[model samples]
Target chain A: MASLIFQIVVDSLLLGGVYTLMAVGLSLAFGVTRIINFAHGDIVMYGAYAAFFAFVSLNIDPLLSLLFVAILGAIGGYLLFKLTLDRILDAPGINQVLLTFGLGLVLQNVAVILWTGDERSTTPSYAFDSWFLSDDIVVAKGRLIAFGLAVAFVVLLLAWLRWSELGRATRAVSQNRAAASLMGINVRAMYALSFGLSSSFGTATGAIMSFLLPITPFMGFPILVKAFAIIILGGLDSIVGTVIGAFLLATAETTIAYVVPQGIGWAEGVAFFLLVIVLIVRPTGILGTVGRDA
Target chain B: MNLSRTSVMVALSVFAAVISPAPSRAEDTIKIGAPLSLSGKFVSYGAAAKRGVEMAVDIYGGKVGNKKIEILFRDTQSDPQVAVNSFTQLLSEEKVNFLIGPIATPMAMAGLPAWRRTRALWVVPGATTPLLEEEAGKEPMLFHTFPYGYYYHLALARSLREKLGPGKTVAIIYSDDAYGREHLPYAQKYFTQEGFKIVAEELVRAGATDLNPVLAKIRRVKPDLLLGLVQTTDGIQLTKQVYVQRLNIPYLVGTAYPQLKQWQDASGEAQEGWVGVTTYIPGLKAKADPKYPKLFMDSDVWKAEFTKRYNREPEFIDVGAYVSTCMLLIAIENAGAVDDKEKVAEELKKLDVHTMIGRGHFEPSLGGTLNQAFADVVVHQRVKGADAILYPKEFETADKFEQATYAK
Candidate 1:
């Protein structure tokens, strides 16, 4: 029983790391622009496809190609923001939501047309390798790598936000757009940069997931739902809160799955249940401020 | 006065022309409605079915005795509501006398009310779940060409028991979807009947990323065999995860996925020694119907023809669709190129020919479906990137069952 509990803890932590990667980008984008990029998961799907093509066609490992994919994703995200989200920044929230939602649907359908609904994966050696902690405990190397990358991503993101000139400017814009504009910071440029950085994180996460999950055109929406739940639970604009929310949801799901009979089947509902509880207790979320301070 | 007389003469001529039949421009034809999921989650199945149907028509020369066969293709979008609209459009508005396709079980179930309204001679090439059978199996017009889920378990339990001996223990990991929940009871009933003790039954969420928790639990019990009841996507995940975890179970069984090239390709080296049940594989030896040699040629020749046209190898759904469409066309032709569906159904019932995926014949299924075809499932294993047939004795390719390579 003790060993099983240990395994569950280890599994939940790893799962939490994966979940964090899924949501932190959404958190970042919402932190600055306050408009949800519904196509965030589709961007991740495209990254997975990009990594997959590099692996299959050019024999590039996803680990190696992730850097290039992230760069490309940043440029794409910048262009996307300039084209669509930038125009709707001042529009009604529902209009922004519909625009992003429609954009997501378009991307998904285009993927289906380009690549038929076939399931694929990148088969790096690590993807199929594992380490045995004991007779009863086994850790999958693919998931461990994902967990490691998640930690590195968060650390780098937080560091940039704390120290970098561009990052500080973006944070100032997120905190008070009107004040930041008055202080000579280009508020729109900062929003664009933040959104681009968020996209980079999303694509990087996709590269990690290319091995861990089945790659399909339709693989995005379910992920997007989970990410949305995490940001809402953690605090929509709080990076740290997003991380906490991801871990909390993962822990609840993993514990329930391990302890309850046929619990894995019920894990999909955990996010909603957790959201309800969080909303009841703190409407703004665990660490969320109601106003514009991210 | 002369201009008015000319205008009256022209008006009378136009009226005569309008009243007369316009040289048969509508044309004599047979209309068939195909509600397939051409663009959504079930796109692969729908695309393959589309190919098979097209090939059957092309090979059959696109006509049956002077009537051009017209197929009205409707995309179900892989949504139940869309499928309902598709059936309504085809059955009610277009009023097609023949219907086919919508491969997934949920899509088929959603089309039931619309189907019941028209009662057209519907030929279904897929829908492995028994839900369709339980709903419309007794309908005289409903012809199911794919084997139900029970056939998979029936063949699997019998074959595995014989190979591993009667007392070997089994563990089942089923998905939480309709596919998994529906197949679980049958898996239990058959495996228990075969004298294998079921040690564990785990339920997994469909499309889940990590299957480690379930795998870890499964490892503790350490059964001899692990049976995964999942569709192609989940099957790929389970297969890869099981291989990664190296559970060391002597046998790993899957339902309806191991034979899929997409699954096999995605699974990579992890596919070795996994047993699965299917109605057709590429190498199965079958002769064409002696009467319709051009349409129902031998299996290998037909496969080569399909590859030449589609530029890819065909999956089970592709083959099943082709065979089903061919049989329906033949029945239509045999019914003397008429619009009488009752006659075509009767002719379909009378069909008994040697063709691919077993005899082109219809009989009652074990699950109480009145007209089921391709119920004989071929139990096969993946060894060194090739399939080795194991069931039905006559089509056996390998003498003995092989354990998973990593396990060995």
Candidate 2:
């Protein structure tokens, strides 16, 4: 029983790593823009599809194609932000939400139109090849690699946000756009950068996911939901809260899954249960008190 | 000439056109409505069936037995209400004498009642519910060019029971909708008779993701086998969670209708040794029936023509719709009239149509009075990156049927 609990923790941590990668991108976009990008999940899905196309068409390895996918995603984010998001920056919350929601639908439909809504997954050589720690427990090599990359990306992102001039500018705009403008920060460029960086994060997650799972055009919807749950649990404005929230949800969900009779359904239900608990107990969420924006 | 007299003359002319025996242009053209999902989840299936129909049309030079066939495509969006609306447009507005389907089972079921009022000849390829046959019994025009869900799912149960002895625990995660509900009764009936314990039965909302919760339930059950009777997206997500959770159950099976390349890519190595049952496999029994395989596989007819016309590899659902359309052609030609829906439906019941899958013979059975076509299915398992037929002994080209032994 102790060993089983240990196993669940290990599994949840690894799974949480992937969740962290997926959730952080949404958090960054929402943190800076104060607009919930419903298109974030589909953006990740598009990244995976772009990588899958490259992998299938050119035989390029999925891992190696991350740079290309990220760049493409960044460019797409820039163009979409310029055309749609830039206009709605100061709009009401509901309008901003509707804009991104409609944009997500368009992106999903565009993928369907082009690829016919067919399921596509990268046929990576090492996808299922995993090392067994013991006779009963095995860890997939692809996921482990993905976890390493996710950690490294998160570390690099934190360093940039803390140390780099661009990161400081982004943080300033997110913290106080009017004040940042008075202090000579190009708030417009900062919003673009934040959105672009978030896209890069989304692309990275997609690149990892496509090699691990079959990606369809509609895959974005669930991922979008999870990101929302994580952002809410982590405190929408808190980056550190996002990371903590991802782990909390992953661990609780995974642990409950094993203990509960109907684990899978229970786990999914628990996300909302957690949301309610957080709202009632500590409305600001775990680690959300420091600099939470409305 | 007074205005009232002119109006009366125009009304008379319109009435005469409706009552006229002659077709608009030539005695040749036969119009069939194909209400299929051109968007959403079932798009690939719809697209593939469309390709198969296009091929059939070209091979017959767009004519069957002195009549030129015109296929009108209507998108269903994989929604039941949308399908009903599409069928209404096809039947009442466009006035197609014959109808092909919306691919998914529920959409087909919902759209079925519309056909009753119009009394049009409707042939469905991908929607494979036994309930359809029952529904058709009340209104006999509904014809299916697909296998019943019970028959196909039974093959999976039989294979599993024989391959893995008795007393084993089986976990199932299925969609809590019509598609899953249709097959679950039959699965439960057979699996229980076979002496396997259903340890866990989890239901997922249609189009829901985050299969981790469901996976957690299955893992807790500690079943020897995990079975998924889910749609493509949920199936894919479940398979990933299984692999990620490292649940090493002996047999992991999925409902493998409308074979998508997504399963193989998504499940990857985890999909290895995964057992599934499907109705159509291009060249599986080609050696025994060389002509059947030759017509479906070796001929670049569909590939060349589809690429030339639509620029894509025809999906399985598209092929289904295409076959349904071709069957409509055979019926209309045999009936020898463009306007008679009942007569066309009667002719369709009598006709034996050969499709990409195999020979289809519609015979009146348990489901209804008019014979609904059923596809002969083979139990297939993935072995070393390729799908190999395992059951019925006749189609076994693989080395052996290896039973999955539980590891403690």
Candidate 3:
């Protein structure tokens, strides 16, 4: 029982790392742009496909090709924002939502046409490798690597936000768009830059997930739904809250699955239940300011 | 001037193509409606079935006697609602008496009401769950060409008992979807009847990314065998996660997925020693049907022909669809190439050909489906990137069951 508990804890933390990567970008984009980026999950899926193609075609490991994939994703996201979202910045929120949602559908269909909806994954040697911590407990190497990368990415993002000039300017825009504009800061440019960076993180998450999860066109929607829930739980605009929400959701799911009968099947429903409780208790979420204003 | 002319021509072509409906069938043509999931989740099944149907048509020379055969295919988009719409449109609008496909079980169930309205001579190439059988089994025109979920467990339990002996504990991990839920009771009944104690019966969300929670729980029980009842996608995830978790169970069993190339490719090292039940594996040697040599050729011969066209080895659905379509087309030919679905249905019931998947003949199923074919399935194991058939006493390739690679 102790070993099982330990295993559950280990699994929860690792899964939380994945969940954090899934939600952080959405939180970042929403903090600054306030657009919700309904297609964030599809952006992550594109990253996964990019990593997959790189791995299969060039024999590049997903981890190794992640840098290139992120850069490319940043460029693509920037272009997409400039072309579509940029034009609809002042449109009704419902219209913006529909556009991004439609964009996601288009991307998903294009992927299906290109890849034929077959389940695929990049098989690095470490994908099947594991470390036995004890007689009864084990840690998967691939997931451990994903957890490490996610931590590193989040830390780097936080540091950039805290210290970098461009990052500080972007945060200022997110904190007060009108004031930042009054201070002669390029608010639109910040939004564009933030969106690009968010997409970069999304793609990077996908590259890591190429080994951890099945690479399919439809894989994004679930990731998107979970990430949306976590961000809402953490506060839509709070990266810290998102991280906390991810871990909390993962722990709750893992514990329930280990302790209760038929728990994994109910885990997802329990996640929504948690979201409902959080919403009723704190409408602005644990740390969100946007929902309070709304 | 040339560029402008070329642009105008391109615009004209695109407009024409967009405006055109599928070429209308002539009065003398035999129209067959295929409502399949051509896009979205179940696209793999639909794509394979399309390939099979097309290949069968090509082999049949695109005509039955003096009449050209016309097939109208509607995409179901893998959604139940969409399947209903597709079936309704095909049956009501097209009004073709003959119908085929919409392969996955959920899609088939979705089309049930629409199908009953028209009562066309429906041929279902796939739908492993007994849901369809229970609902439409008594219908005279409905022909099920795949084995029900119970048959899979019946074969699996009987074969495992023969190899591992009685009293071995079993752990079954089933999905929460209809496929898993429907197969669970049958799995329980059959495995228990075979003298195995089911130590753990865990339910998982169909497309869950992480199965470690279930794995952690199952690890404690430490059953002798782990049976995963999931579709191909989940099967890959379970197989990979099971390997990573290093569950020490000696044997791993799956329903229908271990034989799939996609599962095999995605599973990598985790595929070994996993037992699966299927109607078609690449290596089941079968003889050609004597009367219809061209249509129902030998297994290897037909496989080579299919591979040559599709540029990949055939999976179970591909062969199932191909065999089912071929038999239907042949029955039409045998019925003197008429549009009378009743005469065609009678000819189909009379078919007794030795084909790739097994005897292609309609008989009453054990589950009470009046017209069922391909009830015979093969139990096989994945060993060294190849399938080794086991069971049925006649087609047994290896002498004994092999332990999983990691366990060994």
Candidate 4:
């Protein structure tokens, strides 16, 4: 029983890494642009496909092709910002939401046309290989790798946000858009950069995940739903809160699944459950200030 | 370039000619309506079924008797309402008295009213809910090309008893939806009768991504066998988690795992020794006459053509669609009339034709439920990245089922 508990804990942490990677970019984009960027998950889908194609066609390993995926993702993100977001930055929220939602549908359909609705995966030699830490405890190598990369990327992003000039400008814009413009922070450029960086993060997460999970055109929606839950649990603008929220949600789900009878199916519902609790208990979120107005 | 009254009249005549309908040849055309889920969750199966039907048409020289055969395809998008709407349009607007598919059970059930109203001969290739047999009693036009889900579990239970002896404990993890709900009771009844102890039964929501929690619960019971009646993606997810969590069951059985390349890719090294009940096995030696492959019923010609066109191997669902379409065409030819729906329906009921899967016919004793096709359901096991028939000694590709080993 002790060993099973230990294993679940370890597994939950690794799973949390994946959720953190998925949600952080969503939080970032929402913080800076306040547009929600509904197509964020589709960008991740494209990244996974990019990594898969590189592995199959170029014989480049999935890990090696992450750089290529990030570059392509950035370019795609830039184009999206220029084409759609640029036109509707100051438009009604409904219009912004609909445009992003429509973009997601378009990307999903285009992916279906190119790759079909078949579920695909990249099986590196070590995908199923695992390490036995003890007699009953094991860790999957692919998931471990993904977990490590997720943490490393998160740290790098935090550092960039703390120290870089563009990062400070982005934070300023996110905090107060009109004031940032008065301070001559190139608010438009920050918006574009935030979108590009957010997409790159999302794509990198997908690339890492391709080695761990199955890929399909329709795989994006579920991940997107979970991301929404995470951002709401964390403050929508708080990076630290996003990471904490992911781990908390993962732990709750894993524990519930282990403790409750026939609970595995209900694990997915944990996200929405957390969203509801958070909304009722603290509408501003775990990290949001009481007086900060949007 | 000046326009005179004569030139204007001539130009007007050409415009009218371009826009007008050609002389009606509806009498010389046999229209077959196919309502398939072409753009949603079931698109993979729908697309493959479409390809199979097309190949069957091509093999028939695209005609039946003196009339050219025309297939009108409508997309259901995996929605039951859309399926009913499509079927209604096909019957009422398109005037197609012959129909195939709505390959999912819910869609098939929803479209039953349209089938009854139109009295169209509806031959289903993939939907396998046992409720279909019950509903067929009320709707004479409905026919099932595929066997019910109970038949699959029955074959699987028989194979398990033969291979593992008896008294082994079995746990069933099934999706809580139409396919799994209809089939689980049958699996329980058959497995229990076969002397296996029912250790655990679990229902998972459709499209659930994780199974670790359920696996954790099952680990406490430690059954000898795990039976998963889930979709293709869920099956792959379950196998992967089983390996990761080191569940260590002696055997794993499921549907849709025997023939999909995507299954192999998703499950990776964990796929070995996973058994599934399947109707068609690729690379099975064809019983075709070498001289006239196209004319022979058991020919690999259709398989080759399907591969060449789709750039991949076909699954049983594809062959099911192909065989069903071929049966319909032969019935049309045998009836000697393209538009006689009753005659064609009678010919179908009397069919004893051979197909790529095997001989095709319905049991007339079942009355309105005479639509269920009798086909072989063989147990296939994954061995070294390829599926090998392992049960019912006659079709054994390998001598016997091997124990699965996991990477440490």
Candidate 5:
């Protein structure tokens, strides 16, 4: 029983790392842009496909190709921002959501058209290779590498937000675009830059994930939902909240999914159940203040 | 000016050449629409099915009975709404007379009404839930390429009950939603009738990645044999979790598309000794000629061809898809026309086609008079270094499967 519990913890934490990365990217974009990019998952999916193509054609290792994936994501997000986000700056929230939703559909279809709609998985040399901590518990090298990268990216992002002028401008634009512009911040450039950065992180996550698990175009929907839940749970505007939300939700889901005695199907329902309880008990989330709009 | 005009003419001709292939279907060409899940959860089904369809069409020189046979493919994305929309677009817009699939059951079910309204023949290559046939009823235009879901579960139940005896407790873990609901009644009925005690039955959702919670519950029940009809992702996760948890039993069986290669690749030796009841083999080596069914074991062409083509041995699902397209082509040939829905429907009911699986024939038995007669269910296991077929002594390629040690 103890060993089983331990194994469950390891599995949940590893799975949680992917969720955290996805949620953090969504939270970052939502915080700064105040336009929830419903297509964030699609962006991640595009990165995954990009990485897959790179792996297949160029024979590049998926892990090492994260930089290339990030670049592609930046280009994609920049183009999407220029093409769609610029037009929707003053549109209704519902319209913004629809626009992104349409973009998601378009991206998914494009992938299907180009990639032939096949479920692709990177046969990373490290995918099957694992390091054993003990007899009962083991960490897959791909996932272990992904976890480290996720934590490192989150830290680096936090540092940038705290220390960088661009990050400060982004935060200002997120809090109040008019005020940021009045204060001489390049609000337009900031919005596009923030979106680009968010997409870059999202792509990196997908590339890392491709190494850890299978990458299919359909996986975007589930990841999108999880990220939405995490951002909401962590308080949409709070970076600290996003981080906390990612860890908390990942831990809660992983633990309950492992220990709840029903199976992982029960784990899916756990997110919604947790969402309800968190909303009722602490609407601002674990890290959000009373005034925070989660 | 002359050079520029000549260049313009060349570009126009090139563009025309590229664009004109769309309308060039030969008078004898058979056009079939396949709205399979090219993207989304069941993408592999579409991918593998497309591969088989392409292979079949290639072998047939992309024609049937001197007519060029063309498959109009659409991506359903595995959502019923998407499938319905695709079907609407395909039927109302593209005017395809014959339909091949929406691989999953629910999508197939939703698309059926549209096909029924149009009076078009639906010879689906995949999606075998009983609800499809149950609802189709007297609609003779519907034919299933895969065996009924109930037939598969029944095969598992009967084989296990007969081999292991009725006294052993049977436990099943299935999907919680409509897919699972469709099979519950039939599974319960068969288990009771077969005299095996239903020790425990659990439901798991489609999108779940962890099975530790359910596995915990299942372990608490501690039944002799375990059966699962789970989604591919859940199945892969569960199989790995079971190994990590070191839960061992006499038998563990799974239904649905469990990527055996992925599972084994992830879990290694732990994934050994697992058994599944499937309609096709991703890597089964069978002779080209059905006359010497036994010769599949010795056919280097079968092994070499499958390996060279697929980069892995063919799973039963691959064969299932291959056989499905075979049936579709046979119907096309028999009808002598693809655009005549009525004739295509008529031809389908009279089909007696030879496939990689076995000899299959459809009769006027169910929806659209397409009663399928292929009843043999083969049990496959990953034994040692290869996938060994264990059912029907004549087709037996390896000795009986033995258990591998749990990998924890």
Candidate 6:
């Protein structure tokens, strides 16, 4: 019984790692640009396919292909912002939402046309390999690797935000756009950089996920919903809150799934349910400060 | 005044000529309307059905008797309303006397009213809901080539009883939509009657990616067999997760497992010994029958051509589409006239023909419904990266069912 509980906890933590990776970028985009970036998951889809093609056509290893995918994602995100978001920066909230939603539809349709609706997956040699801690407890190699990378990326990003010039400028713009503009920070450039960096995070997450999950043009919408739920639960602009929200959501889902009879169907609803509860109890989220820019 | 009168006379004469009946040509073509879900969630099946119909047309030399077959295709978008609208348009606007497909069960069900209203000879290729067959009882024009979902489960249940003996416990994990919801009860009914204990039954949302929660629950129960009445995506996901999480059950079986390439790509090496119930088994070496060798050879040639054209192995939906279309052509030929709808329906009722999948005949024993085609349901197991028939003693190509092992 103890072993079973331990297994569930380990599984939840691993799942939390994936959710953190998927949500952090979404949180960052919303934090800096306030665009919501509805197509963030589609960008992940593009990254996954890019990594897929690289592996299949170019015979590049998936890990090495992450670099190429991240670069592509950064460029694509920058161009997308310039083409779509730049024009509507000062538009109403509804307009921003609609624009991003429309862009997501376009990206999804284009992916379908290019790749067809067939589900694709990549299986490296160690995809299914695991390390056994005991007779009943095991750690999957793919999840462990993905978790390590996600943490590394998050730490690096936080460090950059603290120390790097561009990152600090981005934070300043996110905190107070008018003051940052008056203070000689390139607000537009910061917006573009934040969007690009956020997108690269999403793409890198997809590259890691490609080793674990099946890839399809339609796969993004579900993940997108979960990412939104996580950001909302964690606070829209708090990075630490987003990470906490991910683990909380994962734990709730896994635990509820374990307790209820035939509860798998309800497991997916746990995230949204948490979102509602979080909103009702604390509108500012766990770590959020009231009246902040984001 | 005389010139004006002459011009008026000429204009009146031209008007009269335009209003007159046109002369009939030497040969008239038969227009078959196909309302397919060619561009939505069901697009893969829709595309396969389209290819199948086209291939069947090619095989028939694009004609039946003295009439050249002309197919007018409409996309249903996997929407039932779209299916009905397309069917209505095909009947009223295109003036087609025959029809094929809507690809999915809900679309097929929704299009049934159109079938009754139009009374066009409708041959459904892919939808397998038994409810459609029940609803089809009132319409003589409606027919389905694919066996109902319940039939597949019943066959699997019988095979399980015979091959593995009785009293085994089974757990079912199915999608929570029309296809899975409707079939789950039937599976439970049949499996229970065959002496298998119903340990657990679970439903998951369609297109769900996270199945670990459900897998964990099932692992605790430790049923003898896991019956997955899920979509291709869900089935692949379940199998992969089952292997990765080491959820040990004696057997894991479901639909769409015969799609070897898809299963391999999705599940990797975990696909070995994965069993699936299917009507069409690609590359199955059949017993010698004087009438079937040519048909078998032709099917092989068609498969090769299909692979060459599509750059992928043909799915059972593709074969169902092809067979349904071929049956329609044969009925048209047997009717002796392209425009004779009543004669064509009569001919379809009398159809007892062999095609790519197997011998297809509408048995009258099934509630006197002459629309349901009876075909052999073979149990196929993934053996060494390819699916091999393993049940019904007669169709057993592999000597025995090998036990599946996962990495420890």
Q: DockQ for all models, in order?
A: 0.77, 0.35, 0.78, 0.54, 0.26, 0.44
Write candidate 5's Cα lDDT for A104-171 as tens digits: 98888777667654445666656655666675466666666777887898899889987998888887
Top DockQ: which candidate number? 3
Computed on alpha carbons, the lDDT of every model, listed in order, comes to: 0.90, 0.73, 0.91, 0.80, 0.71, 0.78
lDDT of each residue in A1-294, candidate 3, tens digit only: 788889888989988998999999999999999999889999999999999899889999999999998998899889989989999899999988999899999999999999988988888889999999997788899989988987998899999999999999989999999999999999889999999999999999899888888888998898899999999999989888999999999988888887779999988888789889989999988888885765
- Candidate 5 lDDT over B1-408, as tens digits, reads 457888999999999989875666446567788888777666767777777666666655677777788788888877888888889888998778788776678789878767766857776666666777777745767766677767766776776676666687778888876677677777788777888788888777776644546665677676777777765655665565565555556677776544355555434444566777666554444445554232222334545565678786765555566666766776677777456878866777766545566556775432232456455666767776466776655566665445535521
lDDT (Cα, 0-100) at B365 in candidate 3: 95
Reference A-B contact fraction recovered by candidate 4: 0.56
- Predicted complex 5: CAPRI docking category: acceptable
> Tens digits of per-residue lDDT for model 4 on B183-294?
8888898898889998999877666645666776777798888899887767777778787777778788887564687888768778888888877778665575343346
Q: Write the per-residue lDDT of candidate 4 for residues A197-225, one digit (tens) a residue.
A: 88998898888767766788988888898
- Over B332-355, each residue of candidate 2 has an lDDT whose tens digit, in order, gives 667775657888877777766455
lDDT of 4: 0.80
Cα deviation in Å at residue B92, candidate 5?
6.1
Residue B171, model 5: lDDT of 82
lDDT of 3: 0.91
> Where does the lowest 10-residue lDDT sum fall in candidate 1 chain A?
A285-294
Ranking by lDDT: 3, 1, 4, 6, 2, 5
- Model 3 TM-score relative to the real fold: 0.96
Who is ahead in lDDT, 1 or 5?
A: 1
**Which lDDT tens digits does candidate 3 get at residues B1-408?**
457988999999999999998675566799999999999999999999998898899999999998888889999999999999999998898888899897999999999999999799999999999999999999999999999989999999999999889889999999999999999999999999999999999999988878988998899899999999998889999999999999999999999989887788778888998999999888788899898889888999999999999899999888988899999998998999998889999999999988888898999998999999999889999888788899777788887889999899
Q: For model 5 chain B, give the 10-residue run with minimal summed lDDT.
A: B291-300
Residue-level lDDT for B389 in candidate 6: 80
Candidate 6 DockQ vs. native: 0.44
For model 6, the stretches where C-alpha displacement exceeds 4 angstroms are A134-136, A288-294, B1-27, B113-116, B286-297, B364-369
Better of 2 and 3 by DockQ: 3
Docking quality class, candidate 1: medium
